[model samples]
Target: MLTQHTSTCGKSTGTSTGARPGRPSCSLTQRHLQRGWFSRTPLHCPHRILSSSQAGCRLCSGKKRQYSASVRASSAAGAADLPAPRENLGDRIGAFRNAFWKFLRPHTIRGTILGSCAVTARVLLECSEYIDWGLAPRAALGVLALLCGNGYIVGINQIYDVDIDTINKPFLPVAAGELRPALAWVLVVGLAAGGLALTAANFGRTITLLYSLGLFLGTVYSVPPFRLKRFAVAAFLIIATVRGFLLNFGVFTAVRAALGAPFVWSPAIIFITCFVTVFATVIAITKDLPDMEGDLKYKIDTFATRLGTKNLARLGTALLVANYVGAVVTALRMPHAFRVPLMVGAHAVLALNIILETRRLESQQHSQLAIRQYYQAIWRLFYIEYCLLPFL
Candidate 1:
């Protein structure tokens, strides 16, 4: 027989074949007790077998575990109920503004402003007798309209080129996830519409006509079925026509119309047209150098892809050198019109810099940087030449 009773304090005082007094006791052998088997009261201990001396131990242990689990669960629930930390208002505003600026592409914006100023100054300085002082505000409004149009042009390009830009210029707003496609499309459409409206309102019909044409060309350059960017010859012609030829031609014509002068191609206008066309050809061809990877992936037949890289670089460098030489010759020919010494010296230095940068493009990584730097330097030269145009 197994033990079925114990003293009141759970001390083993005797062994008996019958149940204990006042409470039920299980008669179990050492093996059955170790295996957690209870004959009379299975409810007393399901997980843990207990001797007659330790009747209610399982219940007490289960209660402690339940209490611990409840405490942890409540603590977790309380933490989840707390509010999250808030972002600063100023930081949020600043981030949004930065993103919007990147979407505009500040370099091109600067180019538009400089180009407009050059045209205005040329008319104001060279043909002031034709300008009505009362219509000066109209001219300023026309510049603003042109800027909006320029933004639309570039914005659309970014929208279409976002995939390529992710590979070539990942920091751009559209490529970097800072701007959404819908937002980019909205920005371009709004700018285009606003530009057309403003041009029609303040500027004359001539100015409005030219602005509309430029906007159309920009649309054709990036939009599907007519994206001229796919073919090297077409891309070259488009960029050269728009940026080099039309930009100067349209601006000069518009400014002359604003000044109440008949549109006439002055010697100065002809000179700029020819020079910019050649310079723009260099820009058109060389721009593809750093963008080779993206262009190749997208099957864009640029000058860099069609002609070898070394040949493209050499061609671009030679053209840049020629441009500088032409600039020096022009300055010398029209000393009465330009700051001759400054123009000559600046062009010479820019030419030398182009030569050095092109020569440095031997390694792939270095070539990318050198080509991009040269491209940017060319823009800087463009800006400086525009800044000097009023004097001419």
Candidate 2:
């Protein structure tokens, strides 16, 4: 008889049958394509719910079927051991996802479209209130440049730091051998091409400038003696300043051009851009903190390495507070509008996080978590604020 296996997915009795009638087999062997999620070092299932099927795992609840690998092995050992009918399809789908994910993995690509694009959702939404600010299509293209370019730059940088990341980020795609350099390069090229193509597709002339800038920064950030990372101060300026400006430039140009109108920067527009820049700078600094050790060892003179963690944290906190105060000041000075109060409330949360976390991390050991929180706080704050844009 073929045995049935039971697993948990919020308790409905998880059963997968691979055996014939009568008798019991403990095993239900199936091909699993999710090596990273399901079969990592110790292997961890991310969601308690039925998340992605890529990392399929066996269940052992023991009701109609008991967990018995031995019995199933004996029964099905001589069996074909071939890929299940659906497994092949799942693998292909997963490969497709992985390719896209690797190309634009700004937010890790498990959910949402991508990080760069998502970040601008709120900004674009707000800008839309004031101006025609393009729509999702062109905004998406700019985000593509940011996401894919970052991927290219990071991937190429990883090729250089394989040994460094091997020890520091053991599970990093490159470190763990999940992504190879050759394959990564192909993705990088494709994504960059896609970004440029999307620009040419609609936003033509304006896109030419922005795309070139994004791509140039991507190439120079990690390559050559100009390996901009070696110069921490300059690196900080490049990423933070450039990214913040590009976000505004992209939406402003696309929206204005589409509407066939000249762009006007109102107090409201300047406020949002400044807000984005300050917060982006703060988060960028926080990211720099975690790489302190690697930066110091590798001669990377980041803010944390040069200014020291204590000072860097203070700087980050200062920037966060400045962002909050700026928001408040702008809201008060601006004409009466619901967007002002909402933006203030959203940024208030981010400010609180900065005030709390920055004071606590006295040293670099806490960098990993601190850095992650930086991103989470940024996004949560963004979503809250951005959601208000459409209402206004």
Candidate 3:
């Protein structure tokens, strides 16, 4: 019971996770007056954000949608005036066609693609004479689980960051008024349900239990009462450790089942899991650096808040470097036949990218955005996965 409860409220801090939205804190009255009702009145939300914890403001929702429609209409009118009606119609049709084909939902599409790739890779890797084709259902569940999990996280992000996101990332769908935050929450529930159903369609109790835990924890981390964003380090640990390590474990299990291979939880897997988890933490730290201000206002205790921005990035780079060293040491300890040159090459590329980025950081020249995304260009970890799959 304590384990389930402490997942949100820190064991040390016991900070309320659902007190408000975002950073979650004392109420308006509580902030000003500790006790005694002094003409108590409903606190009016100036931004009209109506945090998910509150009884939602229908008027605010309607006004926001109305304002959005007007802006869209005005923008359309301006474009229409510039172009001929026939041309504009043709352009609109083309844009819609492109969007539909590309599957314009960023998080949804990315989740689906990555999930599909990971599962497909696992299945192919386990095609040895010993493994069975029976593991298909399990592999498929992993895909659904990842997708559902992604949507829940994105939904939570949009719902809480409506104010900050509007300022920092206006392009975000909810903050930009392309979608209402409350409606987005509905979509989150629907997606999560669909994902769970898909995962459980033919799975056994073991797989079902795993998926349930993953879905529950991921969703809980996003919802209002928990709002794990306030505890960014905790959020990082969950995503980096549980999500990353368990994802690989699930994939490895499915692969072992399919290959009919011995399924011991090998040290190699442990090494890989630690490397992957640390790498994710590094990415999380980099992301939190630029988001420090938004996090600070909301009382989110991210790496940047705990450590300074430059220090956090530097620390992340150091961890990345350490990860490479550990990977090399682990690889050397492995049987020569299992030691793939491809793995070493992939690690080298990633390490070099980290090193260059770190040097740039030390020089104090690169912008925060560059630090956030530049390393993605290398994407060495994924390339390493491609090599590892062939070996598996």
Candidate 4:
């Protein structure tokens, strides 16, 4: 006969049929089984014969089902908490933009824009009454044309200097393999044509001719058969003529012509041209200092290669200081033309910076860094000159 156990789990629960006298109490066993304590055990009824392994009591079976369901729910929740992976559109666009800007050489672009703006501002100031407000868009287009031409010149320079640049400026587009030569040529040609066309359509013969001449010189400076860059003197003259004389004078003249005004040689224009010419000469000569290795390897006769780095540095430093000094003197003498105090103070600050930078260049560890920074500083001064031109 089986013992009928009145347990807490349920009434009329059967006791273990094969239980020994010293086994756990029936009530305790029922409570443990109901709580899923025997969940890991094989499917069988604890109260039935031990041989009947297929027989599972309802309470234990329900608990086993509940445990499996909880485990599946937990796994599903964990998966839901984990975020899915995806690409960021903004990051990709930013990367592409940075690469394109670098390829364009941001420093040169900045100089081109600032210089064009300066000339345009000076022209407008000088011939304010003559300028038609309707021609504002045309003026904007002219500036864009100038920028394209400047880009073309720089692009061609990089294309031809790829080999030398690999050693001297490996980060440049061509040398770094970021821009293909064929594509670069297309850009150059397109920019050159667009620039000439825009100038001819909007401005007149004076602007167009000057732009064509500048482009011709730039081509001669870089292209084969008449690669002026191979000759230090030719390169220096070409750079100085285009940047210092042609750019300032031609751009101003062109703007004035667009306003139907006669070209006038103002004191400000003369002073600026002189300053830019000297500045460009200094830049042209000193630029070779950092590229000495590649220049020597390629038999390029740069100022630094011919004159030596130390001599070139000293000469450039002196010339730079002199440029600022001259500017200060010009400002003081032509008080009616320029803000005397502002111009004098600006020049004095630039001269002092060169003095400080020269001292830092003496330190061997910091020489390379200081020299590069000083080169950029010269460009900053050039940009600042244009920014202040409106005041003058």
Q: Write the per-residue lDDT of candidate 2 for residues 1-392, one digit (tens) a residue.
A: 22233223223232424323333332233433211222222223323222222223333333322333333343354343445566578886786576445434444232123324343444455455554534556565655555555566566666666666666556566666777777667776786786677677777786577767867775777778677867766676766655566655565566556555566554444555566666567656666665666666777667777787667767877877787887766766764743666666766765787677655564445567766565465555544443444443
lDDT against the true structure, per candidate, is: 0.73, 0.56, 0.57, 0.76
TM-score, every prediction:
0.74, 0.65, 0.65, 0.74
Q: 312-350, model 3: which lDDT tens digit per residue?
A: 777877888888876766666775534557557667777
What value of lDDT does candidate 4 attain over all alpha carbons?
A: 0.76
Flag clash pairs in model 3.
130-259, 130-260, 131-258, 131-259, 131-260, 132-258
* Collision pairs in model 1: none
* Better model by lDDT: candidate 1 vs candidate 2: 1
Candidate 2 Cα lDDT to native: 0.56
**Candidate 3 regions with alpha-carbon error over 4 angstroms:** 1-127, 130-142, 255-262, 266-268, 362-366, 375-389
Could you arrange the candidates by lDDT from highest to lowest?
4, 1, 3, 2
lDDT of 1 by residue, 67-152 (tens): 33433444455455557678799977887688778888887788778877786777767787876878778777777887888889
Tell me which residue pairs clash in candidate 4. Answer: none
lDDT against true structure, model 1 = 0.73
In the range 45-136, model 4's lDDT, one tens digit per residue, is 34542222333343434344444444344445555555777659997677556655776778878877888788788878888889799988
lDDT of 4 at 82: 52
Whole-model lDDT for model 3 versus the true structure? 0.57
